[model samples]
Target: MGEFELIRRYFAPMAKATKPALDGSGLLLGVGDDCAIQRVPANQDLVFSVDTLVEGVHFPLGYCPRFLGWRALAVAVSDLAAMGAQPVCFTLALTLPAADEAWLEGFAAGLAEAGQQFGIVLAGGDTTRGPLTLSLQVHGTVPQGQALRRDGAREGDLVCVSGQLGDAGAALEFLYDTAPATDAASLLQRYHCPQPRLELGIALRSMASAAIDISDGLHADLLHILRASGVGATIDLAALPLSPALRRIKGGAAAGFALQSGDDYELCVTVPEQRWAAASRELQQQLTVIGQVQQEPGLRLNADAGMVYSQRPGFDHFSIT
Candidate 1:
């Protein structure tokens, strides 16, 4: 099929599938337009983020198309969540070696499912022939002056993460055949389909002093907050949350995975000590306090043996071998 025909059949329906149900909507125009028109609600600011996923680098060569569709958009939406913004709409730019009908069908279904789940409409984008790659730009909104920022953390604030970590990293071992068999399904699900913590972010808008989505692993992502906020942190190795599947791995590998494994997509946030009670109550069982911000200017890990330093904290595109 032609490019326009492909879009009409596979992508156009996604635009309508996720149209906001609320009144006074911001999406004035979506797909099929040269440019999307959006209106920022009164007393709110628009938050924007873009993410790109390359075929071999981001996922396996023969990865599932549907999961790729969902993950591509979900990764970008996680950025909005870190800012404590509600997702509004998104644009997609897809590059493909060829337009295979079966692949497009699965991809469209997954993309639409994510849009419907997140209440985000497809805005406008482009498609071209090339190696398989997906780039998504997402738009969200937060009440003026209430958007959580990485630079807002302060000394004495408690650092917390939403949900468990290291599952996705452990899952990667199975995918790459680097580890013995365990529970592959649960781990793969965490790696393939990441659930952005949008609701939790919204709840913490008034409570969190600083926030960041842990796309690049806890150590690296937390350092971002520290640098941006001009502070340091002391994280307890024992406090890192690990999934049952991850913990089952032999030789106590879960700790290393939790600290350095990327693609967990959980939010790492800092809450003021005074607001910890309210924040923890709002988050309920989803929040885990793993550390505290400090007046010093470096990341310190409190381990059972003693204090430890991290040499490599996360994935670096250029540095990856």
Candidate 2:
């Protein structure tokens, strides 16, 4: 099939099927155009971010296209979630080795599924022949001056994280293994599909002083916030939220996975000392306070102030290979 024809046959339908905005908002025009039109509300600020996934580097060759489609967009949209933005629409740029109808159909299905779940419509995109890669740009909006940022952390603020960590990192070990480990399904699910904590992000707009999605594990991602905010932190090693599945799979090294492994996709937030109680009451147990921002210049564990962290801090695409 030709390029335009392929788009019409697979992708165009996605925009048409997307859940329309309630009260007629956001995307003014989508797909089937030279440029997709968006109408950002006057009172809200526009937020957008791009993420790209190369086949071999990001996922295994011949990975499930359906899972890849969902993960790629979810990963990108996590940026909007971190900013506490309301998702609007997304544009996908897909490069494939060949126009495989089966793969395209599966991918489109998964992308459509994620789009509907996130309340994001398909704007427009490009498809081309290449060594399979997927790039997504997601757009969102937030109330003026209400968008969450990573540079607002204050000394004595409680550092919190949404949901459990380390499951996805533990799952990485079983990705290609024919023999599945204990509780592999639970761990693998975390890796293959991560739900962006959009609702939690919105909730944090008022409650959190600083926020970031935990894409690069708690250690690395939280450091970004500290560096941005000119602060330091003291994390309680016992407080890291390692899932039971991760504990079962990783044995004694579960804490390392929780701290050093990547792709958790949870939100790391800093709540002020005074409002931590209110934030706790609102978010309940799903949000865990594992640390506290301090005036010191570096991160340290509560147990050991001067000990080394890990052999490798976290996932660094360039540094790993």
Candidate 3:
């Protein structure tokens, strides 16, 4: 079959498998359109997020198909996690070089496994022949008025992060430069198997007014929230969390990696001081307060003199390649 034709038949149809059970009689529109339409459920705010992963850019070419699928969905869902929304459904669009049955099966299985873990369903998507890219649009639902945004952080709100950071970026370096060591395996897993903190997100729905998932380096990702809210942050270099595995491998560099490396897929949130204890208690499942939002409007790294540094500014799609 032709490339686009194959996509229309197989790839496009895959997206609709879950809609029958997810949407009521009002699906509005599915695939094969310029845009999709759906009725926003009563008492719910529709949350929208998109993420894209390239084959070589995001994952190594030898990366496992199942892990790739898992990571792809997790990356998109991470955005929802940052928004403090409950994942509802998602659509995938994949562009591949060829139709390899084994690869497709493994990829689909991995995506399904992630869906099961997160209580989300595949709604719809599209596929086409190209270099190789996977883009997912994840839809989440929150209380009618409580979907967290990146613009609501108030001065004095605490900056919090879910999970340790930099392991993923460190993994990338390990893949190319270092021999297979104990830390290499763990770091690679961090890059391939991202866990989106959906539970913590739902719990912080009302407490955190601003949030964003760490995709780019922490410095760059936090700048997103800071820019949106017209605020700044003072991230305690000492408080940044580092996985024990990473610390063993990179030592003091782990903190810098945690701050500047991306692909953590962890949620960074800002909660008011009054709600800190309650929010922290609830999100103890997967969160930590890393810093504080500042009245000043610029990014600052609080640390001893001249010790702070970032290896790379952040992941920049346009500039990287």
Candidate 4:
């Protein structure tokens, strides 16, 4: 098929079927127009998430196309996971220097695999010629009044995090500087293919008052929650979770990277003190308590003289760096 024809046949048809928005019956409007239409069911909340991956910025050249496709979708979906929302659908926009049949095939296959895995359909998107960039906007839904928000945290709530941190950052370090170790395979995988903690988010909806995804490092990500919730936190420096691989090379430094390097995609959540035990037990496989919410309105790290780690900010797309 010719390029435009291929898009109309395969991509356009899919978009028409997936409607980005919804109808009166709560059915989603996925793919037919310039924008997607979707429905938020009665008594349900809608979650919207968008992420972009640039060739030179987000990934290095020569990175596998299949993995890039998967990572693009996964990164967007991680926001839904942070909100305790059910995967619904997504729209993709691609900018490329040129189209290659083999590359498209591989990319589509990877996107298809992730779509099926996450129960999200590719509803719509645009393709253009430019520097390689992939952007995805995803929609997820949660029961009415059940989606978690960054502003719902309360003072004295327990602060929690899902899964190990720093692995992705450590992996990036290796990806750019040196060869990855045999054990570092998992870290590299974590960097490339982070699994959004959707299951845990669903489980925590009722228990967690506030939540945010760890995309721009824990310190910055958590600040969103703190600012919104009007609270502060005291994280134990000794308690930051590091993968076994990360611990081997740079011990505490890895933990620091985990705290500030960004792109972890783990969920940082806050639950009332009373709900801690139950939340912990229910999400034991996916969560761990890192600290507690403070009545004070400032963030602090575990250190002598009450050190604050928010000094070194996380990645900002607009930063002058």
Give all candidates' CA lDDT scores: 0.86, 0.86, 0.79, 0.79
TM-score of each predicted structure versus truth: 0.94, 0.94, 0.87, 0.89
In terms of TM-score, how similar is model 3 to the real structure?
0.87
Off by over 4 Å in 3: 1-39, 176-179, 305-308
Give the Cα-based TM-score of candidate 1 against the true structure: 0.94
Residue 92 lDDT, candidate 2, scale 0-100: 94
User: Residue 34 lDDT in model 1?
Assistant: 76
Off by over 4 Å in 4: 8-37, 176-179, 304-311
In candidate 3, position 288 carries an lDDT of: 71
Scored against the true structure, residue 215 in model 2 reaches a CA lDDT of 89
Error of 1 at 78 (Å): 0.8
Model 1 agreement with the true structure over 1-321: per-residue lDDT tens digits: 789998988888877754444666678888886788888888899999999999889988988889988888888999999999999999999999999999998888888888888878898889999999899999999999999999999999999999998888778767755454557778888888999999999998998999999998898999999999999999988888887777776236566658988898899999898888754555757889999999999988877754233568578899866
lDDT of 3 by residue, 147-232 (tens): 88889998999888888988998887776644577878889888878999888888888788788888887898888899999999
lDDT tens digits, residue span 1-321, model 2: 889999999888878754445656678888987998888777889999999999988888888889998899899999999999999999999999999999999899889889889988889999988999899999999999999999999999999998898888778778887777568988888998989999989988898999999888888899999999999999987788778887776666677558887888999999997787765566857688898999996788754443224745657888876
- lDDT string, candidate 4, 1-321, tens digits: 555765675455444434334446333555555665666777787788888889878888977788887888888999999889999888888887887777877777677777778878887788888989988999888998888889988888888898888788878766754565676777888887878888888998888999999988888899999999888999876687777887786654656667887778899999887777665555665677789898788788875343223468778878955
- What's the count of clashing pairs in each model shown? 0, 0, 1, 19
Model 4 TM-score (2 dp): 0.89
